[model samples]
Target: MRIKRPVKVFLLGMVAIVLLWVIHSYHFQNQQFQTDRASTYSELPVAATKVVKHAFGEVTIPVKPQRIIVLNDISLLDPVLSLGIKPIGTVSYLPQYDFLFRGVTNAEAAGIEIVGIGNQPILEKVLLLKPDVILMREYQRSLYQQLSAIAPTVVIDLPSLNYSFKENLRFIAQVLGETEKAEQVIAQYYERVKQLQQLMGERLKKIEVSVINVFTDGIIATYSDNETYNQVLQDIGIPLIPALAKQKETSLFLNIEVLNKYDADILFVMSESKNAALSFSQNPLLSTLKAAKNHRVYTVQQDRWWTYGFLGVNKLLDDLFKYLT
Candidate 1:
């Protein structure tokens, strides 16, 4: 048997190709192990640019904010969590209510540190946490400068208790770069709204409703045309009393006698249960209103109405429909 040089060369070339392929495969596997894909839960794709406006000033949010702090309302917390981002801290103004975290895990597991109770967040403590941004309501703008000096803060004020929860959820979703989640949430809310609207519109016959807020001190406050709740009422085809329809000059205390000036078919009174129940039970004047006489007076809890965030509005609408029917 004669050994040919070309055959020897061919055998060596085949061995080299096999070894190279094995090495390439091993390297690829190692690269994948180093690049972690487990933690990314739909992070925003675009670079978070500077949002500047006359009212909000300049806010620099990382297109993807890893750490966040929530102040003011706990109601808005659920949507943030729903978007797959957790807050490092939150306010403990009301401890008992749990509507906001319906689908979230146990409070202990959620691990949301309590930053402060009622008054605005402790500026010093929040600065220490080094949050990328802070969430706040509109009235809290007084602390704008102090907060902005520490980190970017978003001041949200949706006019009217009737402010569409879906719209609100969408606004927040946009801010958090969770447009898909927002769309899904809004769609669900809309479905509920449509069903309620159909039923309430048919049975109530476009009845007028008024949302009143009362304090323990005998001061009465009713929603103005611009309030979010009013918008919710209008959405269901409910009419607002003439005076309420005309936006109030102010948002603060008014006397119960003011209710007389703006009469409506249904009256939605909001206040602390203890105080509202006491007023309705004891105050002859409050009991004299037409709605009260007919038992149309529905007392809603302030905490629930005030803090329900985006989904809260839907709950409110559902309640209204239930009351109307």
Candidate 2:
């Protein structure tokens, strides 16, 4: 063929453009496919019916449970709400500490009914709410038969393991078919923990933090390694005083005379009532402590620290950011 050089050049340019267009189209489609796949996985449909294994045994629960009831353990409320599930009724650790519910705005606004307190739930009140599912601690197993009769009950071994807040959150998530939400909440929590570590810099490792709760009767309570607040402190690399770390129980209570035994760079004193605070301040040993002498003693709310759960831990972290920084 007797083709001109200019014509051949024009044809080659057209071919190159066509090839470039095809490559671009393929890449765009591939990226779109990946985006769609991720979206699908993230919003995967929950099952209609799921059989969950718990302390009591295997129980089938509705995938999207409504009218949920949380009893015995108030800590369960945080995880339930974190999963975007609002319980119809929940127990309080104690009537006096119902203020703890303030941590969850949704719960407060939802006016979530209070059915009972601690392990002493009012069966009549629970049944009246007509809950689809009930979550309770394993210690409440005695009421399982009765609770299950009203709704599918899932018993979690919270007390036995002294499970961390994340562990408990995941357990509740599994029961409610919200494992994805649980993971997301946990990821966000640890991310915040990392940010805290960065903010504190060298101080994170250098500080010795003591957490204590003062009572009206001259008793002092310190957290164990298993407590949720302590777990958060551990995550941020904050060391506890040696005296507290040696305790074998979930909490160690001491008389006011031995307060000096626990020394730390900073002290967090939690008191539930005015009398407790007054008692703590009145103690002569209060002035002798290293943290007090250094003017590093800070008062914290008992409900936020003494309670184990997600919302409380987050609040505690916020306080740490304020105090440590």
Candidate 3:
């Protein structure tokens, strides 16, 4: 029953080594946790000021803003929502254009107050809200001084060149310290595009797509290079009709006679109202177009198709998936 001294000594040594290894591992992990916590806090100091270059020179903003007021530019709604931050006040769009606020199902539940309309924001209402930061577009420059007096105003200038929905989201994210979330959102969006492409197969490359808005007055067709919806379609690998190849400075209002030139394998018609759809359908040339004849013409909501933002793009994608697939 006697154990060998040498074997017992070796066993004791092994036990000591294992205990030391466990303690070292625990201390290393604890130190690593503290280091990570310190790094995160350092990156986001309370009351930290970050200088952001916007449309109107440079402005310093808090690293973490509590109350944000989004004015005029409803496009920022999507990015703000994605970042999981609620703005204290926002400008209201027209009722017909409610799709601009699509995906925000519980605005009332979340306490998002509409302070005013895009063109005419009620400054008195905004002043009551007392937002910490104000986000707006350059077009609202007239109200800059007043808004700045109320809070730190950051004006986002729509970039003329290489501007995409993702770029816009990144700008908003940078202001809110949600750059990581912005990247994730962009990646998820492209992944959805990839899924749609897979479902579409070769048709994604060969199909000619056209996006046009039907109004009582006339039709406005958009080109791929400039328009946000068309740009997304181009990214999904759909080819644009030759007529839409050259970018116009703005959306072109075409008469019915020239509408046939822009006909495509698939047509997305953004109708202003039910009457507009009816009128567009009644056009004599409607039956002759390939998309119309084949029943591939989709009557989409004008707001959902025209609005420039992450949510709008995703809604457009949803419609494409519903119809094309």
Best by lDDT: 2
lDDT measured at residue 4 in model 2 versus the true structure, 0 to 100: 100
What are the per-residue Cα lDDT tens digits for candidate 2 across 1-325?
A: 7999999999999999999999999999999999999999989975578898888679998988888988744467767877777788887665675363534543442778878765578999999999889988777777889999999998888864457778888888877878998999899989999998998899877889888888888898886788777788888899888887787886778888888887689999988787788778877889998999999989887666655566767888889999998
Cα lDDT of all candidates, in order? Answer: 0.65, 0.80, 0.78
Q: Any runs in candidate 2 off by more than 4 Å, and if so which?
A: 1-47, 97-109, 159-162
- The candidate, 1 or 3, that scores higher on lDDT is 3
Cα error of candidate 3 at position 251, Å:
1.4
Instruction: Give candidate 3 regions above 4 Å deviation.
Output: 1-46, 95-110, 221-224
User: Lowest lDDT 10-mer window, candidate 2?
Assistant: 100-109
Query: Could you tell me how far off, in angstroms, the CA of residue 296 lies in candidate 3 after the best superposition?
Result: 0.6
RMSD of candidate 1 to true structure, Å = 9.0
